[model samples]
Target: MDVSNAFLHGHLEGQVFYQQPTSFIDSAHPDHLTFRSTLSDASLFVYRQGSTTAYLLLYVDDIILTASTADLLRQLTDRLRAEFALKDLGPLHYFLGIEVVRRADGFFLHQRNYAHELLDRAGMLNCKPAATPVDTEAKLSTTDGTLASDASSYRSIVGALQYLTLTRPELQYHSAGVPPYARLT
Candidate 1:
């Protein structure tokens, strides 16, 4: 599911000020709305009422919601719709670069598309997989290569690869050697 115009939903306690956007204003009626900025985990949110529980995972405006029962799921979704301009995407298929496959037993998630995108970004789309990603016996130094010509692009690919860790734990074994905190937030 998704929240439409999520930036407009913030209700602040104190006075907020914003300029009237150029395109929307006539010379006469010049009023504008303001919103508060906030920071959050962008992770999971759990709701519980008696024996019923609902789980909501949030990433920016995108949301993945589930509940203890089908009825609860519908009720929760309806409640959200009332509060916000929520778009019902129906069953989950693809989210956050991960593909969802549903079966009788359970659901499976993978990042094959994300992997391909990463390879393409790194200019390795047609490259074959290496027998080993790195030399087992090789010793590494802090100063290895000079540096990437475009550091931001390098960081972008590394960050995308990091997100893939949700579905590909083995990727954790290989890294860009860039400090984790060094990446753009």
Candidate 2:
């Protein structure tokens, strides 16, 4: 489910000051102290009842909630709706570039589309798939290859691959070896 204006719903703790925009200057408070809250994995909260557990994963404005029982899920959704304006997008299908498919046994999460997009962004959509993401025998040296002209694009692809490893653990080892940006000494 998606929360409308999720960031605005969060409670601001510390004091934050901001100058008024030239167009929308508030006469009451020309210079205002605004409070904003940022969400992270550390903000996740779990509720357990006996063997049943409900998990709440929060990533900024997006939230994924799962429970062992329908009743628990309903209760949690109601509580969240009461606290914040929520738009129920029905069963989870796509989230954070990960496509979720429901199976009789459980759910299957895949990033096939995301991977394709990444490849396209890297101009490697037509590239052949290798048995391994990285060659085990090949030695990568900083001085071996010339620097890429588009360093930002290289970094972007590497960053995306790092995120893709979240669902594909096998790629973790390969992705970990890649530096965000290439450097030559």
Candidate 3:
């Protein structure tokens, strides 16, 4: 999932400008533009080498890769590193705020770091961690507490939790509930 041309491959409704290329030095018009922009797909790119294959993922400057062979992976990584300024974050531990965990059971994606970030952003970072998420016997109702004056904030927390559920199905009950602060009130 590589963005072909990436920044140069997107549609622009308004004007875009850039300095002339070093190779295309314009002595006649030193300040003149050397390139005109165009629109194309930025979501995907394909590169093939013999029978082995590699996939490049590009989101702006961020990239992830999958390869059919280790040698191919190494070759692709080397080539990419040489061409672009990149950091080799080996083994894909984290991407797009989702944490990747490999276990005997299977691969798991969780927002543990993302969750922590959200909690910190919402000032819940230092809150005590409950032994369990919610009390099984605790009955939840819509009319439980006073309406939050900033409903948007409450909703934002819920939305973050909802995204967390992509890897944390077990937390669905806890994530989708009315705002925890409201519940306390």
At residue 2, candidate 2 shows an lDDT of 89
The residue pairs that clash in candidate 2, if any, are none
Worst 10 residues of 3 by lDDT: 32-41
What lDDT does the true structure give each of the candidates? 0.71, 0.72, 0.64
Q: Which lDDT value does model 3 have at 172? A: 51
Candidate 2 per-residue lDDT, tens place, 1-185, comes to 88898677568789988764434645786643222222444546566766777888777778888889999889888978987899998899999888889999998877778887887898877776554555779989988989988999889888897887765765544345443121100
Q: Which candidate wins on TM-score?
A: 1
Off by over 4 Å in 3: 1-44, 125-185
Question: Residue 89 CA error for candidate 1 (Å)?
Answer: 1.4
Better of 1 and 3 by TM-score: 1
User: Candidate 2: where is the Cα deviation over 4 Å?
Assistant: 7-44, 49-52, 132-145, 172-185
Greater-TM-score candidate between 1 and 2: 1
